[model samples]
Target chain A: MNHVTDLPLWVAWLVAAFLFIGAGLTLTGSFGLYRLSSFYDRIHAPTLGTSWGTAAIVLASIIYFSALQSRPVFHEILIGIFVTITTPVTFMLLGRAALYRDRSENNPEVPAMDLPKDILDKLKLADKTESVYLESGERE
Target chain B: MSATILLWAITFAQIMLAIAMVLALARMIKGPRAQDRVLGLDTLYVNSMLLILVFGIRTGNTLYFEVSLIIGILGFVATVALAKFLMRGEVIE
Candidate 1:
């Protein structure tokens, strides 16, 4: 009673293969999410799943459906595009939030913050010292 | 013959996705901090979206694809709002 029943054996096998590969990549990415230690590290892990992982699965879906229906189907592209654009934005915001929290807490893991006043004062003193040396050199 | 094989493969994939979902849920429940929990939630959303997609493949229906899309959008918005809240204590400020 199924439509795919009428499709050729090779076509069905190809669709299955694509689905498996996509699902495997997604599983690997999520597994990395569990295995990774820090938030930043974990952030990179999901990208694997979001980027190519979603692509493969969506491609598989498109191929399978189009072949089965004997027509082009592309609605899955919407999900693919949505995931691609949103993943980076979410990761960046999360990374920035983590950085802000760490800096506020004065966590030793991050580099020291550059203070504006300290740099400006150092620059002024350096300029004065340079001018004094230049005047002395001119006299000599 | 091929239909049977395809069914078996799809079932296998479904099982794998279910396990992945469980792992994400474990992370969500076992978080040591708020941000960890948020990260876990985000991961869970992605896993669930994929799960729905796999279901669509198995059932040979396009309807589940729409659901997956909705889930993706909602997950993105939810994670973004949570991340913003993490930066400042308020979602809107």
Candidate 2:
């Protein structure tokens, strides 16, 4: 640890508070991951940590460094942005892969991959109605 | 006055994160399937990165920031690779 005299009291306290909040959010998210039942449900849990959880900590870092250096140090935004974009993509891919494997194995836990023909026809009709409603909403 | 309060809060936060990591590790070790293990690993990586950020705040150093960033990238790649392997039974397929 650096000597205590290096930082002003207020700045130290501010950074510490930010760090605490960020870590708390992260812990909650991870805890959710463990508590949630089923793989698909677990998938949503990490997003809590990846999105706002990562953002809060990065913001804390930016705030701390900028305050200490007396200038804006905003490069930490890169990791924040990278994570925000990549985490969703990874989660989506993993979910899809799991779904595929489950379907291939004919796992009863997962729904059938291809809907019955009647259901597909009904879905198409529903989609058409949805599109028409969307267009009407846009016009209004 | 407030500084002492903030210090106590941060210490509490670190303790929470440590507990979270342990929970994740337990899931990783107890997983019944390969995918579950991979998911645990992913969670572990994200938690560790956040832990590093907290340490950076404690030490007031920008260097730890870089380390955290690198760990994030590495973890992302490793998880993706493992997920791919799970899908195809090979890393490069």
Candidate 3:
């Protein structure tokens, strides 16, 4: 903060804007997690923070430090990139885990593992319509 | 003019980030389900990391940046472990 006063007016404003943007996104995302009604829906909320939220903050840091020191500082980029890559992995794993648990419990609320037993049973070998609407995108 | 603006902006941003952490913590505590709690905890980790970065900007220090990086790593690992346990009832199976 000592060197902050030494910065050019425009640079200071720029740093401030980025920091506010980053922090705002993060706060809103967390808030969404709190207000969302369903667990599945809530999972998507944090991605906003992890992605652009992290980006904006690190951007501000990079700008402030580079301006103060008069040289580009690239270390902050590591945090940005790391968060981007790992966040999706965690979310995905968590989603799959949640799905697996729900499926195993035979929760009537969740989709069945094999396309609704009653519907599957009704379809006979003689029907032969679409096989499975998603079979590698190859048309008949 | 911009000097004071910069200071206030950083302060405001820090407060926002801190509020975010509190909201995440609330969700973590109020979670009706295990997965919900895990999601909240993950969000908490991320918000806290961002808060640290804002601190980095405030004090003009590289040390805070490094600390944020470490927190990011820890958050990811912790979430992954918790998710794995939730899926299979075991952290390392």
Judging by TM-score against the true structure, name the best candidate: 3
Where is model 1 more than 4 Å wrong at Cα?
A114-140
* Candidate ordering by lDDT (highest first): 3, 1, 2
The DockQ values of the predictions, listed in order, are 0.54, 0.42, 0.75
lDDT of 2 at B48: 89
Off by over 4 Å in 3: A114-140
Docking class of 1: medium
Model 1 chain A worst lDDT run, 10 consecutive residues: A1-10
DockQ of 3: 0.75
List the pairs of residues colliding in candidate 3: none
Put down candidate 2 lDDT per residue, A1-140, tens digits, no spaces.
44334557777677666677777777887787788888888888878788888888888778767876889999889889988888977777788878888888999999887788998897787687998767776999
| Tens digit per residue, CA lDDT, model 2, B51-90 | 8877776676778889989999998899888888878888
User: Candidate 2, clashing residue pairs?
Assistant: none
Worst 10 residues of 3 chain A by lDDT: A125-134
For model 1, how does the per-residue alpha-carbon lDDT over B1-93 read when each residue is reduced to its tens digit? 767867877787778777777777777787766777888888889888988997898788999999999999999999999999999999999
Clashes of each: 0, 0, 0
Candidate 1 similarity to native, TM-score: 0.86
Cα lDDT of model 3 by residue, A41-126, tens digit: 89998888998889998888888888889999889999999999999899999998888888888877777776776777656532
